[model samples]
Target: MDLSEIKGRIREKSNIVDVMAEYIRLQKVGKRYRAICPFHQDTKPSLYIDPEKEMFHCFGCGAGGDVFNFIMLIERLDFMGAMKLLAERAGITIGDIEHKKGD
Candidate 1:
């Protein structure tokens, strides 16, 4: 599949809380999950994860995004690499997509 298709699959299969919990400990807070920001030296919980939105944001470091973006930042991966990683984690296979000359 193409990048957009892969991204959609990743988002549908990967839960924000589940993926984030794999990297850090998370505590339920109201309608979201809270944890210390891994992108910075956070002494207090500054990362908030919204499962409903499938997104995360750090109040301390200003880092935020969906599951793919989170993985890209945390794992230091490019877009394709992040997609492959999350696809593997979600047991979703991404078939090779032929890119156009300009793409």
Candidate 2:
């Protein structure tokens, strides 16, 4: 499979709410959730996460994107690093497996 396909699968498998919850306290609001924006000095719950949409947006800092983008920003990691981390969390294997399996 292509790397993009794997990335898409990882994104789909990894829940945005669950990932954000691991880093910050999320309060349930209606069908969505809210939290203090980590990107800026936020006293209020500026960070809003919509689990149904699998996306997040921070009204304070204007930070918004999918789970991968969130991980990159919050974790202070590069795109590939975030991808690797999320891939492991989602139980998605990376690199060659068929060759290694035979060995």
lDDT for every model? 0.88, 0.89
In candidate 2 the C-alpha lDDT for residue 32 amounts to: 93
State in Å the error of residue 18, model 2: 0.4
lDDT tens digits, residue span 5-40, model 1? 667778899998999899999999899999989999
Best by TM-score: 1
Model 2 ranges with Cα > 4 A deviation: 96-103
Lowest lDDT sum, 10 consecutive residues, model 1, at 94-103
What ranges in model 1 sit over 4 Å off?
98-103
lDDT of 2 by residue, 15-100 (tens): 99999999999999999999999999999999999999999999988999999999999999998899889999989887742332
Predicted structure 1, TM vs. truth = 0.91
Residue-pair clashes per candidate: 0, 0
lDDT of 2 at 91: 91
Q: Model 1: which residue pairs collide?
A: none
RMSD of each: 2.0, 5.8
